[model samples]
Target: MEQVKVFTIDELMVATKNFKEERIIGRGGYGTVYKGLLPNDQIVAVKRSKFMDEGQIEQFINELILLARTKHPNVVRLLGCCLEVEVPLLVYEFISNGTLHDHIHNIDGASWYSWSNCLQIAMDLANALTYIHSIPIIHRDIKSSNILLDDSHTPKISDFGASRLIPLNHTHLSTVVQGTLGYLDPEYFFSSQLTEKSDVYSFGVVLAELLTRTRPLLPVRQTDQNCNLAAYFIQSIQEDNLFDILDSQLIVEATQEQLIFIANLVQRCLSVKGDDRPTMMEVAIDLGELCKQPTNLSPIEREM
Candidate 1:
């Protein structure tokens, strides 16, 4: 792959039309993402990070270097970057379908995405995580919002701002805890030891979101504060009420056996102990097999 080239601040500003509000595609704690069209007519998604200190700037550079080195079908492709700007800008391939979050939640009034589609999307994400973990990179954040889908409905894992590059020889690395609360690994929260398993845990939450069709966090009642869906899921599983919490649409189409299998996989992933969680490779293999089975095939045929 060709090395990612850096763009001048003026070039980026021009491409994004001075970061016009109309071009804004996404926003987060770190920055606003805008859609840009280069002079060559190449479309891109540009991330303009918020104000930062020297340490944060260095970290952003490190993230760019890591993104440049990564090239996988399931991983978001980085076109280049602009570091000379007041806030570092990251350019990535424009994913037209937006985020997995939007599809699952239908926040924009779109029809609910199919359960099978959700499963396929999760499989693609798992494959990406497997690739990232192969190089021993731990993506501390692995939620629906971080997954961008292309026009073809293929999912690509994005947002590596919170990722940690673990040395091949090391089992774990110590760092100040950072990650979305609901999706964080319980072990990492307590020990402050970051590992690939942390990513596994977060992926589990994503899997749950796919199955349940609910946000990671949401308000429980008008009178009560919001609750964490992950915690709610764990409790439901333990209480033998998984079906009650599962998405109604998914349940209508899924067989009892298929539901049980997926629930079991989620259970294994959300294991309180990080060591008990399956590796991304194992999860990918299981999900790939699930995806290949004929959806409308009879249970007898599936068994055969």
Candidate 2:
């Protein structure tokens, strides 16, 4: 655990070109992230928080404290911070290859969308979750867009504005439910009791997105009336229509065993009850085993 560096506002201003609009890379509930070039020629992501109220300040400091001590290969690294002004700014390592959402949905993009890549990314994220949970911290937000990619297309989990650190004796926390619409854990939403399993549920949704290359919140379609992806996915699996909703590329390229294995894993993860879901370590181990399986034969070819 290295100490987080304190950066000056002047340095940040110079790095981000005075916070120019064009430098903006991402915007979320907490703040906007800008692509900055440090004086040392290091490229970084500068997160400028949106509000300075008590609640907002709590999240900011929570993220700062949590990320300062947290260091994992799969999780985004918090390099420094600028607290000279009221609204604090955070600096993180810049991930060059954009997000998992971009690669999954951008069908025409140069990035590869192969099953192996998806599996690798999932494993990376699962490993990250396991590490974070071991520290008794809940990410609270684990979606495709929050997952950044390095130049090698490795997944790096980011965006900890909604994270929480659980006390040593507590198995769960009672807090106002906050998460993305499509990926939110239904149990947490209704009960307001957040557990690590909430993150598992969101990770399940991300896996579904990888297989389907569809948005978590599906648009209205002629045959499918359900707009929520988790419900749609579970329904499809139960109806034995999983293949119907899966990406055509995956159907052609992935083995039947591999697809079935991951589908079952995702289903278990998306269970309505948090207690029914597997731990992050379990998910990571399962994925590690799946990654070892050979991908030489496709489902279509094997059937033929």
Candidate 3:
């Protein structure tokens, strides 16, 4: 196993050219990410944290330790970190294609976003979740923006600043709520008790987003009044208009049977009660079986 290197602040400074604005690749509530090139010509993303407050420091340490132990193909690799700085910085393997959110929202990318590709991405994510959850880690925040894609469009789960590791003695951890708005688990939000199912609920939102290619908290269509994708998706399924809310591309390319199967799975995942949701392992198995089914699309459509 490769050890997580403790990088020097000076080395990171040179890699990012003294944190030049031109090197910036991403920005979030936690901090900014810069494209960095190490001395050995290895490309990486350097995350410069924003603060060193008690909570921030705790989160920083939590992420560092958890990521250091995690190993999964669909999980972003933490190459190294710099703790010599005031706020500290995390170094991650650079993923060239950007985030899943960027691709889904981009007209050019979404135009060719095939259902088969979407399903495979979902499977990759589910498997990643299964691995982390088995390690007893709750990703607390699992959303499209936190999911990065490589050149091959493979999804890798990222941003574990809000994740938690559950102890073997405890069934759940009672902690302050933390996660993306639309993807947050209602049961955990209300009770302040975090569990693995919280990730399942969040993953449900991501799967819903993938199938519809719509923002989790925004109206997909002007005629739609609902802003919450979870509620809107459940309502659509309950009202027997599931196909109407799905992406036009999905409806034409995916078999009706598979669409319904996945939609039902999504509904179960979004259940209000955590116990009602399926485990990540179960979800991965279901998706794997679905992917094995023959494609309904023609060769041209499959290539889309």
TM-score of every candidate: 0.91, 0.95, 0.95
Give the alpha carbon lDDT tens digit for every residue of 1-304 in model 2: 7578999999999999999999999998899999999878999999998787887778788899889879999999999998998878899999998888988888688358788888888898999999999998999999999999988999999989899999989999999999999999999999999999999999999999988888999888754577888889899999999999898777776788899899999999999999999999999999999999988575576798
Estimate, for each residue in 102-188, the C-alpha lDDT of model 3 and write its tens digit.
998888776549888999999999999999998889999999999999989999999998889899888799998888899999999
Q: Put down candidate 1 lDDT per residue, 212-264, tens digits, no spaces.
A: 87788866644234387777777777878899989876776666777777788
Q: Under the 3 Å rule for N, CA and C atoms, how many clashes does model 2 have?
A: 0
lDDT of each: 0.83, 0.91, 0.91
- Residue 21 accuracy (lDDT) in model 1: 96
- Candidate 3 stretches with Cα past 4 Å from truth are 220-225, 299-304
For model 1, state the Cα shift of residue 22 in Å.
2.4
Error of 1 at 235 (Å): 2.3
Q: Residue 283 in candidate 1 has what lDDT? A: 94
TM-score of 3: 0.95
- Give the clashing residue pairs of candidate 3, or none: none
Global CA lDDT computed for model 2: 0.91
If both were scored by TM-score, which would come out higher, candidate 1 or candidate 3?
3
Backbone clash count, each prediction separately: 0, 0, 0
